[model samples]
Target chain A: MNLSELLDNRDGQVYRLLFYDCRPLLQHILANYNINDSQREYDCIMDFYLYLRGDEEPFAMLTAIKSEKALPSWLKTVFSRFMARRANHDGQTDYSDSAFDKIPDDEEDSRIFTISDLNTAITLIEQINTSYSAPERVIFFADIDALASNRHSTDEIISVLHCTEGNLRVMRHRLKKRVQQTLAKLTTND
Target chain B: MTDTLIYKYAYNQCTPDERRAVRDMLVSDFSECFAVVGLMKTRAVNDIESSMLKAPALALAVSPKERRKTLEKGRRGLPDVDACKNAPAPKALPDIAYDEEMAEMSEPIMIKEQAFGMSMYFDEMPLQPAPDFLGILNRYLQSE
Candidate 1:
């Protein structure tokens, strides 16, 4: 059936269809979090479900959507917002908890960071270097540089840094964790 | 995402840091670049469709590809993303954060400066006409 028909469902079949169609995307989002408790996980899912199904605004937004293919990405943002809201409600302050800490500010999607904010984040990231040879600073700046120039290559990075694939993986994981910590600090300090 | 935010992002009208943050999201998060692109596409298509609906004759005159190109080019008043990387460091504006609230509050006061100033002459002196008047008139008439 077309998106219009799916959207016109009166028996809540739309949510069911959406849930199944976007299950993999939702599952992928959830997998990043470290929610160990089954009950909390279920609660998060149920809350997100209610958010989508109960809100008139979300439904209204859905009406403007022309393609079913776009729904997954649009819903991805919705699910992301819900996750941020859940994290905020939980009152979790520690950045070491899980992947949820990656998104420290619930309003990050809409937040406009200034150059000063980027500089501050960069400084904090640079400070997190565990060793002189560590590639966090290089990698972070490299990625940002790449964003502008559209020239990022893993092979180039490895060759320049004289690091192996295994070492690069470990360093990236470390850098990711540090970046999360820096992001959390930024939100709190602001 | 808010319409303004989506529009700014899709049309490259947001600040450098704002663009960087969104790009960082794509890189650091769940590889949702494709999905994010889809979302942006939805917003863009809605805008294009609405404009086409408003002017069916104009829409018929322009091919879809040409219309899309015009939309992207016209709406993007800023430099391209590649140019942004190489552009000189932006001289810092006032320290106030450019949040949504600030945007709303400042909207009334944010007057754009004219690119050219009015001609200067003595009050008693007759106004000397500019050499480029005919060119300017032609350009203005063509735009209309």
Candidate 2:
């Protein structure tokens, strides 16, 4: 849907929800990415809001909004694709056939995080921690931190990190796998 | 679980079962849960000493100009600092409690009284009572 159309249809609920819920989710994402400066994060959030609403040119706006000199290539690509899809829906111009037709077959299998998806994961993690043993809780925390840090190597993760090898291996084999599966399920639903 | 237990759990100081019970209570009765949370938050803020609770932006609410004027006026209108410092502290409110509804309704009447007092500053003359012209006529009628 067009930005205006979405706003009109949702009657400000979208903006309210974005500020109330999605802003905190974005903050969490930024924290995971090690972007801790509050002002920079605030600007990035405002930039994202303006970009989504079609108020500014996409790439130029992103450059002005982000404090970093260059964003990760993967992030830039994802953002561009998101913008292109939004532009197309907004009826500004159609994406090239090449752009429209190229779907990543891997996306069907890969996990992506959405705001609600992350909230549910957090809730489940809390529940598990409440019900689990102390060692199990430590394992859960390690796995969650590992996931947030984007470090997927189980063996390297075990040795370099402080937790016992057995616990780390169990966490990697079982807990991490469960988290990934949960994330995949959420992505599919989204 | 009780509200006190829920408040403790909210602060992450409760046992696992207590935490679970608190969470279950919150999930079922969210409004009451949030009220407990709100009270905890208020107490937390209050526990921080005033000097330690400074936020620079919030200080702008009382402008420097207004602050200076207030100080100057206090100097001129009020008693000397040493005398005021030596004076006994004001008495606390008497140890009496009223119904909640009466307390709530009392505020507006107090506010009206304050407003009436403020109006005297704008008006120079003191308020006078209305003349009673009918008193003489009533006296004459009674004599007849």
Candidate 3:
């Protein structure tokens, strides 16, 4: 089914596949890792998707993902597995279901990242980041590292995140709202 | 998400009731969750770089001398009348005798006479009065 149709009938298997197969795990990974920064995580997620789609060079995707520095341990593990799988297949089966299936379902509960979930999150992140401002993008990036590094405090985050006090406040408020809107859109479809 | 709700939430401009509604939506909706995640990512990245990436210096470079030459050529190529017209008008009073002579003369003779008279007047006077005659002369010149 088309993307719109998939979104509209939220009960459909495809939507279920998208959610159960992707969203829930992605959310768990982000929350578990405390990846509070949306932008960098979003980029990492997009790079992961592009890597899955065979639309990006593996080395480039790896480099970009590495730069984010906030990738959850599970995500890194899944990525290594994905890389191994890709190598074994010689890039010929980049989009194959088998590749995604290799990620064990039980491992998901272990907070082990699934390639499928990362790919899906990457896709969603790419779609939303295109509409965000520069400052918003930075905060999102810093949030990933901050969460990963266990650093918390609006002032400290604002300093490391490189935004003014007022701007940080505004960005924090606006970003949270936009995230909610994007989530609604993703699920609503029509 | 509701636009009003999103706007309110974004600005922290929301009431407690609105904030609670936003929190509820964020918690219940997967789409909202992902969006929040994405937005947060964007904000994080924005911290380091916000300006559009610049093209390489070689691509943007234009030598100062080259720019100056271009500007000079542009100035030279402009119409003479436009250049002359834009000069601040001289603050001196009108040459009364010249004005009286022109007023007495017929239009056609005045035109011909003034053609030579302008050069003579300009040469003779250290400071020329704002050239009120120039406007009429320019119109006549254009018709020719």
Candidate 4:
């Protein structure tokens, strides 16, 4: 039988498929929002399952889905609407366009490091510091500072660090990429 | 997955429809959102670093440690760090080409095999028992 038929039959395998598939969605909601309670998280996932099992509209919507690939995004929309509605019922979410603006978009990218992303990067550096020797870590952090300080010329960095210009550029670039890779790993580690 | 649309979205260079598509995904696409944020952060830093690379170095006013602290401090957030530690594992983001034909198209899967623990991103808070639907479902299966 097709996935839709298996879903319609409420097959155990289908349940497993969806459970694993949507687990990340559940994780995302719990991670990003202020909801920290495990019970609440359980209820949220259970509610989504019930919504999908609903014989009226949700089940119909599930069957209507053409591509299995769209299932994740479609489920996300359902969750978004679910959260929005729940927030409205609880008198918490502001429906105005301004509210989304306040939802906090990419503050770290805006050069504001007083937030967690930067701290994660730092903690990540310490965690992976073993990969690099002691001198490498010190020099990398220092050179990034020098370049970022707006006071150091490339020549000055090379001279002060007692390294060739190419070495300075290559080492700094490699270290920066490592930091980015670590952050990416954190996000993609499922 | 590295899609031009996601790149455009990161840069705020996409059209309204494309932006809407990406915005919708951001709600559930935690990994994608993180990747996009990383991309933007890199771009922002590169812009500044590139400019600084060419400019001549002046008098050494700030010590390297102090200067590094300032830059790192600018990026670090204790709360966000805590949040990262408490965060669960993230799945791959779908590479959906957002356009007029997007609705009809099936996204190609591009899952990365990277070693990362779900609990590594969140804070020092003790992990609570995560809800598992399969456990309940398994009970029903046995009963059946």
Candidate 5:
């Protein structure tokens, strides 16, 4: 139905289309997960529509999936997360290991490590890691950003960083610990 | 998956067997991942919407006079439509005439015309005698 033409709008029609189109998908997903709340489903749909109103690329992307006629993969996660936040309305997210086990596959979570957050984390590392050498910091951030793109293989990373398996493992260990601390601070402060 | 394990998974650090197991678990338990998505959308709202909304108010606040001045300035540079549509026609050309003396020399003639300038130049250059032509012509008559 020429979704781009419809969605590349700062108009009422775009909102109407998104409401009619995404409502059922949001309902189906929530229903599948047994949340069963029409209000929450409507809330998710409204959130998506409002989100779409402010930007074009996301709408362009969502529209491009017209043939699929399903909730775009990312939005499914987004809607689910919306419900989860409603569930966690009290305060700070629980930071226990149980929390990790609870939501492992959510690539776009509260601690999802955004680019700005990553930049802040990098700056924090620079300020904090007085002992880490210049080359080490360079390799560490470079490797982390590449990993974040989620496109590289382990062998590719090892070769690019010019490190052996044992050395790379140690580097990853150090990076994981540092990133966890930095992102924790960044998320809580936000 | 442990938080460390999830971090490793995000970075492609987990081995294949570990990766498979973790993915299976996450898929089997998909609903909890919603909170993470919720946080992401919250961060994105801050990331984009605020900046986008700021630009429009600044755009609209430009004084009407300033906008009019800019519009007039842009119009000033455009070519005049009347001037383009009524471009004058080319001036008429003088007629061609054969020169009797030049024709007597039996030389090759040259003609040049400049259309817009409405000018033409004519001259005749000496044509070199060629053995082949003379031989062909010889059969029709006596050689000079």
Candidate 6:
């Protein structure tokens, strides 16, 4: 069941093409996050693979947002998106509700820090981002991923994004607020 | 992990931060490190299996009933728990305010809008990206 062999299967074919086409995107994203944890990166890539298999939303955005001038850069835009999502942590924290009693500062809850937890965190972030405008969400997540990957300051992000510091602050504020709300929901569900 | 460390360490090309990181990884992951000599001795650049080892090599789509058969043939890869025919149903996600919408969204999804007396496909992108779209998948995957 090696890659060379799996290339014969439909899923394998899709993965092979993906591996070829998105190598740079994944490499850049990999350099930023999950470099120390290759397995987690693998799982994240596999998740994308399944979606490619499914022909599923954001995936089709590549074609949906097609315009002659924008077509070529669309792939880069999409890569920026997921790379942002994967790095959504951005050193953010939410207040734990009393309903979810305060966890002791005990040993690590590896389960809570596992790859699945990160997946759930990503899901919650996406759910919260649903109401935001497309451009806003893209900038927000990409900025967040930038923070995680580059450990950049607000000043740096503002400069890199060619946006004002006020705009960056507002984006960070909105992101943190959404993260808190999502954490509340996850807390109740957990 | 071992291969990564060995390559970085022996080359002496690591940045100060990377050197610290490698030290930390070594302290934290002693057991997972490969034997430096043995790994080098056995590894050949021409080995396709070695190069593709980290790639999603196993391509499988099987009902639980057939999973056992597959396992009988080879149990070397990551075990797919859902492949077991008799495995218990996945626990339902606890009902939250948006539970129904979330559950419905677990399926293939689309966002449709009617505007200006017409059905406008605003952000009507599907997750089925051609040539493997990553960001879109993460967007939809996180939502699911």
Which runs in model 4 stand beyond 4 Å of their true positions? A1-4, A11-14, A30-33, A90-190, B1-144
Regarding lDDT, does 1 or 5 come out ahead? 1
Q: Candidate 1 residues B49-89, lDDT tens each?
A: 22101211211122345435544544322113233234343
Model 3 agreement with the true structure over A14-69: per-residue lDDT tens digits: 22221212322333333333333444333334334435334334334333443212
Model 5 spans with C-alpha error above 4 angstroms: A1-5, A8-11, A32-34, A63-190, B1-144
How far in Å is the alpha carbon of A90 misplaced in model 2?
Answer: 60
Using DockQ as the measure, name the better of candidate 2 and candidate 4: 4
- In terms of docking quality, how is candidate 6 classified? incorrect
Candidates in order, TM-scores: namely 0.25, 0.20, 0.23, 0.26, 0.21, 0.22
Residue lDDT tens for model 5, B1-144: 243333333322445565555455444443212222222222222222121111122212223454354445442232232343344422322211111112233233232223312121111211222232223212211210
What DockQ does candidate 5 have relative to the true complex?
0.01
- Per-residue error for A158 in candidate 5, Å, reads 58
- Specify the highest-DockQ model's number: 3
Q: Write the per-residue lDDT of candidate 5 for residues A6-93, one digit (tens) a residue.
A: 3332223333233332333355444533433433344445445555555666666656564432434545565566557645662222
Off by over 4 Å in 2: A1-122, A130-134, A142-170, A183-190, B1-144
Q: Highest TM-score, which number?
A: 4
lDDT of 1 at A183: 48
Native A-B interface contacts kept, per candidate = 0.00, 0.00, 0.11, 0.00, 0.00, 0.00
Residue-level lDDT tens digits of model 2 in B1-144: 264454344233455566567666555543332233233332222211111111212212323453355445432221133332344432332111111112223222112434324233213322221111122112211220
Candidate 4 chain A minimal-lDDT segment of 10 residues: A110-119
Best-performing candidate as measured by lDDT: 4
Which regions of candidate 3 fall more than 4 Å away from where they truly are?
A1-120, A153-157, A160-162, B1-144
Distance from true location, Cα of A17 in model 5, Å: 3.6
lDDT of 1 by residue, A1-190 (tens): 3333333321122333323233334544554455533333434554565466556667766677775455656777777777877777873323233543354433533332222333343334323321212134344444433332345545655543434454444445555544554545665686
State in Å the error of residue B64, model 2. Answer: 84
Chain A TM-score across all models, in listed order: 0.39, 0.26, 0.32, 0.39, 0.30, 0.32
